[model samples]
Target: MAELAKTSEAVHRDYTGAKIGMWLFLFTEILLFGGLFLVYAVYRTKHQADFHTAAAELSVAIGAANTMILLTSSLTMALAIAAIRRSAKTASIVFQSLTILFAVIFLVNKYFEWGAKIGHGLYPNSPELLAQSHGTILFYGLYYVMTGLHALHVLIGIGLLLTMLILTVRDRITNTDFVKLENSGLYWHLVDIVWIYLFPLLYLIT
Candidate 1:
């Protein structure tokens, strides 16, 4: 009995450590994006007209759709964690699957959006973009850099959630030991929150 007690205490300690580690990792991510946001603010202030014109080139409809998709995914991800906590394994799997689907959809939308921009010669280092004013050039440069980074994060989140889904399927993540899923959910939420900020700064800026 003492042995079992010791093992349980060790597991609890591991869980606590894992949670703290994830939070620290998230804090670092926040700092990375926060610095970029500060850079964006400075440039936008210097070239408000260029920023407004550049933002006009982006499609609000597409941006709004992707925002809704990510918001829904966040909801589904939370539901997945909640379902697992309640020991509803099937519901958890369903929600996880839905979250993955939404993520894929988002990427697909981004693909077409990027393709259209590239087709129009808006991509970085392209002759068309190089001809633009200094402010316009800076705006597009920041747009591509920031949004590309955020998209990379989305891809990483998808991979993490996929791993969590597989673990849950294998019963490695269950009601009593689901910190892995919780951590993945937190990462996914960070991705979503970053977009919440990005959508406005990149898409809705006027």
Candidate 2:
């Protein structure tokens, strides 16, 4: 039974390695956003008035709604992990599906929000945007870049969660071996946390 023992050891090593790898990847993501946040702080300080005025153009109602959506998705993701750990496969699948649904709703809201701004000629490099104060320009630039990046992450999270759902259905991610689901949930939470910061910084600058 030495072979069996060696196989068990290898599986344990792989599980530990996967967790470490996911954490390292998340750290790099944090670094990327951290640098952008620093840049935003510098610019906002240099042109506080312009930043405030520009932020007023954003719809607080919509931003708050999206914030709620992501927060709910984070909750569903956590519940998904908890469900799987308890061997409630169907419950896990439902929670995962709900998480993805919330993500989609968040993106839909963002799409309309961006469309409204674009229709009003507020987007980067638009004639109206170019005519705005330098601070206004910088504010919109950072807003678009940061929010767009976060939306991309949400899309990626949806895909990851969808995969997890499929795997759960196929019995691949059972109660005993669910590290993959856990990793996906961690990533999804990061996306939500990023939006939590972004909403206040970009949408509530008053």
Candidate 3:
């Protein structure tokens, strides 16, 4: 029994190590966005009027819709983890699939929103934006940069969740060895948290 105990301990240690690595990577992501937020705060403070004007141009309805979509996705992701832990493989897959569906919906909304903005010649380096006030230009610039980066993260999260779904189907992520699913859920939640902050800052600023 001593040999079995040693093997079990090693497995637990590896799991703990994996969790630590994920947390550290998440911290780095926080710092990356933290810098952008700092710059935004400074610029917004100095150019509140222009920022408000630019923010008014954004579609609050679409932004709010995307916010709801992502929040629901987070819920579905959490449910997926629970379903897996309960050994309900099919339920877990369904929840994860729902999460991915929500992600795709969010991206579709963003694509249309951005397309409208670009159609109006409001994008960065466009003559329309170049002729705008410095604060307005800065507002749209940050909007695109921040929201675009966040969307990229959403895409990455979709990929991760899809992989988790496949693993669960193959029994590679069974109830007894489901850290991969849990970690993927954690990452999804992190993405949702970032959007929680971003939605208000960009869309509700007026």
Candidate 4:
């Protein structure tokens, strides 16, 4: 009985430490993203026409769809953590699985959208990338740069979620030891949150 109480207290302290560290790491990430956003703002003001034209070229349908998918994934991820907190291992696993599925959907949407743009000469160094308009070329160049970076983060988030899925399935990590899981979820949520801010700014800069 005393052993269980001691274990519980130790677990509580460890959880607090892990979560705080993750939050601090997220703050650092915010600063990085903030700097990039600053650069974007400067370019946007200098080339408003080109920026608008570039924004228009982005497919709103796919962007909006991915936004919804990521939002849903965030919700599922939250649910999974909640389930773990409640000591419902099976429910947590199920929610984590769903979160992974939503992540894949988001990746697929991003891939298709990006690939189409690149195929249509929307990438730097591509023969058709510049679209013959000064604004189009500059705007598309920035577009690819920003979205490409964000997409890389998305890919990393997917890998993190998959790691959680594996840990849950293999019983290698359970609710009792969910700090790594929580940390990964934190990272994934940050990725989603960054996109939430990026989407409207990048796509609606008119």
After the best TM-score superposition of candidate 3, give how far the Cα of residue 106 lies from its true spot, in angstroms.
0.4
Off by over 4 Å in 4: 1-13, 131-134
Report clash pairs, candidate 1: none
lDDT of 3 by residue, 7-84 (tens): 886566567777888888899999998898999999999999999989999999999999999999999999988998
Residue 98 in candidate 1 has what lDDT?
A: 97
In model 3, the clashing pairs are none
Evaluated at residue 186, the lDDT of candidate 3 is: 78
Poorest stretch of ten by lDDT in candidate 1? 6-15
Cα displacement (angstroms), candidate 4, residue 43, comes to 0.5
Model 2: residues with Cα > 4 Å off, grouped in runs: 1-14
Question: What's model 1's lDDT at 59?
Answer: 96
Better-scoring candidate (TM-score), 1 or 3: 1
TM-score of each: 0.95, 0.94, 0.94, 0.88
Q: Compose the digit string of candidate 1's lDDT tens values, residues 1-206.
A: 99999788766657778989999999999999999999999999999999999999999999999999999999999999999999999999999999999999999999999999999999999999999998899988998899899899989988988999999999999998899999899899999999999999999987
In model 2, the worst 10-residue window by lDDT is 6-15
Q: What's the lDDT for residue 55 in model 2?
A: 97
Name the top lDDT candidate: 1
